[model samples]
Target: MDHYSFFDRDLSWLLFNERILMEAEREDVPVMERVNFLSIYSSNLDEFYRVRMPVILALNKLAKGGKQEKEDVLLEAQSLIEKQQQKFGQIFTSKLIPLLKENKVTLLFNEQPPNEIQSKITDYFFSQVMAFLQPIDLSETGKNFFPENNRLYFLVSLTLKDNSKKTILLNIPSNQLPRFYSVSSDDQQFILFLDDIIRHNLHRLFINEKVTGCYSFKITRDAELDLKDEYHGDLSEQIEKQLLKRDMGMATRFLHQPNIPLHTLHFITEKLSLQGSSVVEGGMYHNLKDLMGLPVSLPGLRYSRWQPLTNDQLIDAPSLFEYIAQKDCIFHTPYQSYNSILRFFNEAAIDANVQEISVTLYRVASDSRIVNALIGAALSGKKVKVMVELKARFDEANNIKWAKKMKAAGVEIIYSDKALKVHAKVALVKRLVDGRIKYAGLLATGNFNESTAAFYTDHILMTANPFLVREMELLFVFLAKKAKTSAGYPIEFKHLLVAQFNLKDRFLELIDREIENVKKGLSAGITIKLNNLEERVLISKLYEASQAGVKILLIVRSICCIIPGVKGMSENITIHRIVDRYLEHGRIFIFNNNDTPEVFLGSADWMNRNIYRRIEVCFPIYDQHIKTEILKIIDLQLNDNVQAVGLNENLQNVILEKHEPLIQSQQEIYHFLKQEIYDRV
Candidate 1:
């Protein structure tokens, strides 16, 4: 048995968010780019509260039978979140806002603006914002006021002539209109947030009532759902109906401005029944995440956007299938256009020899060309089987809509069985080649989304190997029946490891080999790149390997619970996180077994949900050229001085700034791919 120093998952996620916040504070980043990072941090935090925080809260509520150290984990998570929030405030106030001012962009309050700026703001508010305003009085009735989640609201402290104060709420119409409005003053340009615009017009909103003072605040609700077992209708419908009511869910965090009167805050808190640890006090602005969606009209306020380069093989091929048959091709996305994926589906749909197609759909774009191709294939008499995962949170509604479309188009749709959520990104096509059965498939590390493909670094393997394709065929058969996958799909698979059967044990066995090799005084090492690392068994095995003198290099993008560089424990392990132009979104594992390097890529992360609950596949890279390319890419990312964070024992995001030449991997990868295409041409 191996022992490991495991950081709490919540704390690990906070570290990732901290990295994003650091980007917003970086002077090298453009003003708009910094704001975008801020937005990313805020949005990522929202998902954390909605998805992961609920689970932690639930675990804390469980009896002693729950995880043994539940309270310890929850308390650590709460404290960590609070501390990060303070950092977030400091960055926004001390760094970002000041930079904006230096650039002639000002987020002004109503207190002391120049006369002309104030006049312009008042005019703009009356003309554009006043029509959308609807203020509600919270004094006479003490009614429980509810604002939509993430919406900014002002809790006005109205004082009559008799000096009696009453509270009222005014919601800023930011969702419908622009969050920031730019105005001109001589040679300087000014930008004001929509919240401030509402603040400037507070007196006008309450004409008959005297407005003594106003303060800004917002509420964040505990947005989790526990589906009841008694629903008789479709599960998708039940979930959809429940989601409609998500806006009015129980309050999780009530964020109030620090300047709000104690009496007013207390009365509102008591009336809304938000007692206990749910209330959080903070800055004047509520949703800084809206800054992410800020329009970029200024000439040089953002980084230069790069257009996705097309693959040489895809661009020059006479036909997608014919080209794919020649050799295995790998696509590292955002650098290489995802049009090849759309082409694969489009070609398969029209190919008369294609008899059946089976694919897993987790998330898809709204105007998904892939869905259209699947429908076309079904209409053309090909058997199209789609396993639409309607449980993909925040995307459930869209998946449900697409599911109905696929069903209506004569495609056989297999909604995942309630127990498991199918997250594999494998696509299988059975075709007749020269009067014989053949299969060509594409396995991806990300979704088949065209929109996200431009910003997420993902991997997609296109192959025609019968040995691998046969196993994919068996996977489809097994998905249709909810049975344990067969043990005999390809008994000689010296490479690929499929979960729910032998993947976990296989991973452990591989680590043991590394451990054994290190004990024999051989050069042994392991390098892993993943989205998360939270599974205990895997972490323990890795720790054991590290203890046995294996040099461990980890590139974990989010939620890494294993702490590194601790004496007598994780001294051999080092971790890095990259947050840059594109999201680092692939999983790759390399174990140096006595100088005979073994590499694999696939859908499964080291996370528990992926290993135990979901169906995933990790296939070894058998092609020497592809393996070299992957290693080169990894090396480039490791050398990145920009947008990379080295994790400390305390998991502080220490920027890698050792005076080395700057190397941003995403940019370098794009140049590499573009050069490859040019050479082929």
Candidate 2:
């Protein structure tokens, strides 16, 4: 590892956010969609400060040398973020504002209304916003004024009649009401921030006080929870207790308006004990994530709606199990419908042949149809077991609630081992076929949550392959018996790559095989698509292979630490990142085994957490047809020029220049899968 130089993970993540910002800068994108990109950039940055900043802070608390190293990284990350924030402000003011004006929509930012809409704004503020206003005197609540995580607040500089100034912290209530209030005035549509509405009616709230100034601010607290594996108490209860403590965590970021007077800023920071926090100067609006919910409806302002296509195989089959039993089927989500996944659970619940079902629940939707189907199966007296990962950060409460519901419904809910999270997205169904036991498995590169399926690019393989399904059953049995056995239980997997056992070594072996092929003067190439690639062990292996002349093409969506195109280190490795309408959430790895390629897709990335700290699975694409389709899809993404950017040595997203034929991978893949439906018809 010392022989390799890696990019800082935090800095690399900022570069990824910069790519999302670049999408807003693209002129070809629809105006509203560009606004959505800005919202995504803002939302991503907020999460980074909440989650990743805490890790850096913890590292800084270590010995002197480590403290200095982490402090430097923190400074670099902050500098990059400041630059991105500046670009966001420029894009919003220069491009999006003017575009909205041209489309007969005006977003009023720091400007007085043109006298016609002032009355309407005042009326709306007094009626709607006044009730939610509860300003706390910071002088009274000093050091205990807990700014709830990620919520907007207005720090008011008030002057009383006696000329003594007092500061009040008021909640903006953006959570309770819409961030953008729409006002229709004589053929001209206008959108105003709820911040401005509150600003306009500030005098009404403080009757005797003279409001000298008001500035917007937001606080992002550390969101990481400390849930120890006590082995004595219930894991769900531990998680519930930690979720309550999330709001009381250390404040990581305090973002305030740039125009705040130095004295006011000092007062707020000192009173709130935010002396060492990352205090950032931002625009008048702090949480621009609200921009995503902008209430404006205009023709062609948004991306053309794309409906997920129904899979022809599932549509025509008399039974989903029967279809899967014949051949392996793949569903590329959002492009192809997720109904096939729903059908898998629904048919298993009602089909008399299904005797038992096992699934891994990571992040389930609030109103999960899959959970309903599992409950139905339990009510039907089928043996149902679920391994719900309760430590999926920010999704713990929802998972715990669903876990209780499933347990009450007689579903055997297996809580994840506190030491290892079950991040694998797999569901296994055991059915009695022809008086013998048979298995059907649904393995995917993403969660089983259907809501995310509508907007995430993932691949699900439905296979009744005896070898794979049997291995899946073995894995489930291991999970069911995990608590009873010691942590060192030897669970061997032959066909599938299981993390903590052989996934990491198996990947290394595959890469080494490519290196061996290159040594033998045989053709060797590696193509991988994953959300994050930060594990140094595998990265060093890839660098080694690159030196051996094994061409490596990586499509890493976020947090890639490996520096590509560096001489004597990773000169042959090329990294591309794709940020578009749908999140690129799938993990596909391909190795040219002496020209006969081996393709594998699964629920694991090369990140250390996924490889070492979680129960993940990466199964081989054994079926030739499905394998070819996966390869073709990866090829399409590799050749994409529309939404893909090359991650160069300088950590800049270099967009590939368009040739005669412009390739947008998502659209092309949709049409390609749509053609599959036509071919089947």
Candidate 3:
């Protein structure tokens, strides 16, 4: 049994979201940047409910009366989410908006209006926003109104003097039009929500009946689409059809204003038949995630943009291939330019000895220059094969678009079995050097997207080791055949932890070693940095190790289930979460076997889907200097008292207080890297 056997995974994820909110609530952070953090927190919560919570809820409903534990966890998750929503309300209303007002920006509503400014808003709405108003009458249509995913809606309840009440749903055209409408009169910039603009023009929207009141609201649906393997058609066409069906998915959540009347709430819930579903009562503003792009337009309100810094190694090298031949190089994205990854493919495309290029396309940019480079390679008589996964959620349409384009350019496209989505981010290049097969591969922790690479923290390893290259080429062949038995690629691996075979064993062995070492009175410990940690077996192993007196420190970015510091169960376990300016990605696991530690960097987290299902690799750090550098970064994050949150025995996120000077690890890392560049220069 795990130390955190009682701790729920869904509730732990909500705590992660709360840490993001803490960043927004920090007085030390820039105001506009804090607003962006708030938007990210909201967006993250939306995805949590859309993907995770619904599945948990569904899982609870299975086995009928049994599994009291699952039901209790769900109830706890629901309660925690409501608490977070209330905190979000307080932060947005009491703090962020007021700060914006101090900067002369106003988020206006209908009730609280200066008389002088009411006319300006009224005239602006009638002229510009009235044409966009399309209200749906629930009584007239006599059908349930369902909202599209992430789309905004208005819940208007009307009370006539004769006591006959009517309710309607209004669609706010924020996605089509701008969410924030800026109006300038004298000095102040009056920015109104798209819903508020429609609200001001309500007298015109209602034809005959008097408009009593209006409130902003919206509904979030379960965005998961069930695209089974039975569909015998073009995957792209099938995905396009699913994209259309997504808007009409079951409404899992109803987000509405708190002040809404009881009858009105009953009316909407009964009409939509949302009898057993979750109903989340929220503040006046429905979709605060839109505030990420708040149209601040003011230069000083946000952080100054920093141009991506190129690696000094790239600048000093004779050529990319030549440099790889000498030594392996890792490009940590955003800090190091994504242009280097692009250059690797582009150079391969133009190299004379290059024979073939194979890549796994999980998620790529719409305007992907990398795909264009692959197309160029194919056009230049290079055998280019792309295993494009068309099932990546939210990016399926974009992946489908790229697939059609790549296929049209004469590239061999391999579609994986629909049951398993190929999520490995790998690109392999085979070149004939003196008539011998020489290969180069790019393995990354994030999607091969240049735009997100600028903001997301990911590690891309570019290497040409013959043994590793041979394995990578074999892996590509396996991927092409969808890992079939007839595929020539061997399943045996000593240096790589490839999933479906050896990864789980390797991880379990590492934990078991720690447990044994602790029992032997030797120094034993484990340090892990991962995006999420929720695998039951893995968590249970950590608990067993902790019981054996093996110290464990986990820096999990999100979705942790292993409760730390339980008195008799997990006294040696500690969990830390770092929420800084840069996302803490790059999964690294270290096992301290009496001070002779083994460190590995990988493309997989400890989540069950990654360990048991996905084709993930955990490769050992060979270069001593690189290992030192990665360890240094991890240590900095561990020592961070500013952005770090400690999870206690009760699974509570408690911020560590420091009486001395603060050390923000992200900023410290920037300075650390800058110093390295300076020393090299």
Candidate 4:
């Protein structure tokens, strides 16, 4: 047997999703916040069915160890989901609804509108909801109406004038209208679902028929995009073509409300060609992700808001570039404002000294200020080069839109090859200052998205370090050539640890160094924070280090395959996850180099795709102050007893026991940065 064990990646992800459900069930969590978690849980589970369930089903079919084994695993997985769904129903109907009713708002789940608001509901349905309704009769033979993926539809069962059963599929119109309809009558306020609104008005639509049942349902299709010839044609065009066909992939799950008749269920399954798909019996609601539309402004029902803090140096500096040239500075987002990073690009766009700006964009925001800055820079006769990864899943259309806009504005847009994706979040600005070509850069642990910056916890670094900036420019040049090289691109990256080249090797060397230090009776440890951890080579190296008496601490938010606290395998490894108001997204790696620590931050997670199929950049921290700040923040997270939960050998997230002072890391982080600003003042 091997010295270490690994959990299945998909099941590990399911465990992470389960943690979200657990958050929804927490009484201490603000009721609206708990509702938000419920929405997030539903959204995440839907995506899992779209993306991962197809792989699981296919593997089960092709398993050589008899279909019985795979069948048992499937049944186990199904059982887990059923229990979660039951819990979801209990929490939403029993706990949350009553809690909201106490606060003077009524969310009509399965119930009809109150007698006081009956006429108003009828009027609103006629005037506002009728324009978006396009119901189709299933008895029609040739019209071929396909149900889109994860879209809400109601199977209306009717008894016609001839005393025969007829089924019609009517859309919930959530895409066009709001998922919720909020109305008030005197002292009481009621929130209604569009699904319930339509269900209440079903009799008016079928005047001659008796409406028996109106049940909610949806079909979740595989989200895998077909890009077979993506490398051949225009990459953006190919993605555009594939986006049209994405919703038509094989059905992975067919979810419906529990009260549908057997004949109606059979009719939908056969007509939609979802014969072998996993059919789930659900509550009256199909997509509870729509719960996010609920009002979060209810007093005492939401977490207290903390305004983002500004980087004093960056904001007060007369020249943002000059301050960075003097010393490297870093900003933590959601805790710190994103204006400093924005100023980085906004300054480069109009600066007369700046000649060229180049960057790699993985997921561009829909309304991106950075892209607009690049457009302005290019239009101002400055050379702007952008490598936009057309394969950024689910955001392909948005990225393609921005790429075309940038290209049209004279900004050179480089499309990454189909086989390799450049996931480096790095940007460089070249300036001719004082008759010298000066280089400055911005590196980050997340995408350059201002929208996500409001909620995603990330670290952004601004530096005038010549070596790293020069290496970033070299990377842009290499990416422009499609990154096609026989032996790792021939260029040596000394400052940046780049994947597909020195990344894996350098990480192994780091882990091995810790193990060697342990052998020397020196202080040795490895602390890493990542969104996911699945690459086996680095995991095995970590296991080897753990066996050599190196203490490993990990803060993984999701999808961790490494099992911790296993006897004789990973006894020294401690892993925990922190779920809070904002997403824990930053990736940090710290190596205890005999008390003098080394820290690195990057966008790369040690997943299989990051190691082999992508070009990721993880950069070392040379500035002492920035490194210390990162270490302190990570230390706070390590000591967090409120939001953090430790993982056991069974891959279960166990709540950490609270001590004298509970450290909620995100809250503490905010205060820490606030204190730093105060100290600087």
**Global lDDT scores for all candidate models:** 0.80, 0.90, 0.79, 0.90
Candidate 2: minimum summed lDDT over ten consecutive residues — where? 63-72
How many clashing residue pairs are found in candidate 2?
0
lDDT for 103 (candidate 4): 86
Residue-level lDDT of model 4, residues 1-681, one tens digit each, is 265579888888988988998889899999999999999999999998999889888877767556555433566667778888999899999999999999888998888677998988899899999888888988777545789998999988889889997778899999989888888888778999988889999998788999988889999999998878425658789889989999999999999989778877888898888897999998889889989888535678999999999756567788888998999989899899998888899999999999999998999779999999999999999999999998888899999999999999999999877777888899999999999998889999999999999999999998999888888888888888875542756788888898987899999999999999999999999999999999998999998998999999999999999999987889999999999999999999999999999999998999999988899999999999899899999999999999999989998889899897989999999999999988878
Question: lDDT (0-100) at residue 235 of candidate 3?
Answer: 67
Cand. 3 TM to true fold = 0.94
Ranking according to lDDT, highest score first: 2, 4, 1, 3
Scanning candidate 4 in windows of ten residues, the lowest lDDT window is 64-73
Clashing residue pairs for model 1:
222-252
Model 3 lDDT per residue over 180-296, tens place? 877766777777777776776776677556677676666677888777758886767878898989867777777888787787788778887776667888777777888887877
Q: Residues 1-681, candidate 2, lDDT per residue (tens digit)?
A: 798988888889999999999999999999999999999999999899889998876676663566454445776788889999999999999999999999999999888777988898988987888899988887664335878999999998889999987888999999899888999999999889999888988888899999999988988998988876465678889889989999888999999998899989998898887876889999889889889999988989999988889856568889999888889899999898899899999999999999999999999999999999999999999999999999998899999999999999999999867878899999999999789998899999999999999999999999999889988998898888765332577667889998877899999999999999999999999999989999999999999999999999999999999999998889999999998899999999999999899999999988888887898999999998888888889999999998999999988889898896899999999888888778877
Candidate 4 global TM-score: 0.98
Estimate the TM-score for candidate 2: 0.97
Leading candidate by lDDT: 2
Q: Model 3 Cα displacement at 412 (Å)?
A: 1.9
After superposing candidate 1 on the true structure, give the runs of residues whose Cα lies further than 4 Å from its correct spot.
Answer: 1-3, 58-79, 109-124, 161-165, 185-187, 228-233, 483-495
Q: Which residue ranges in model 4 land beyond 4 Å of their true spot?
A: 1-3, 64-73, 141-143, 229-231, 485-488
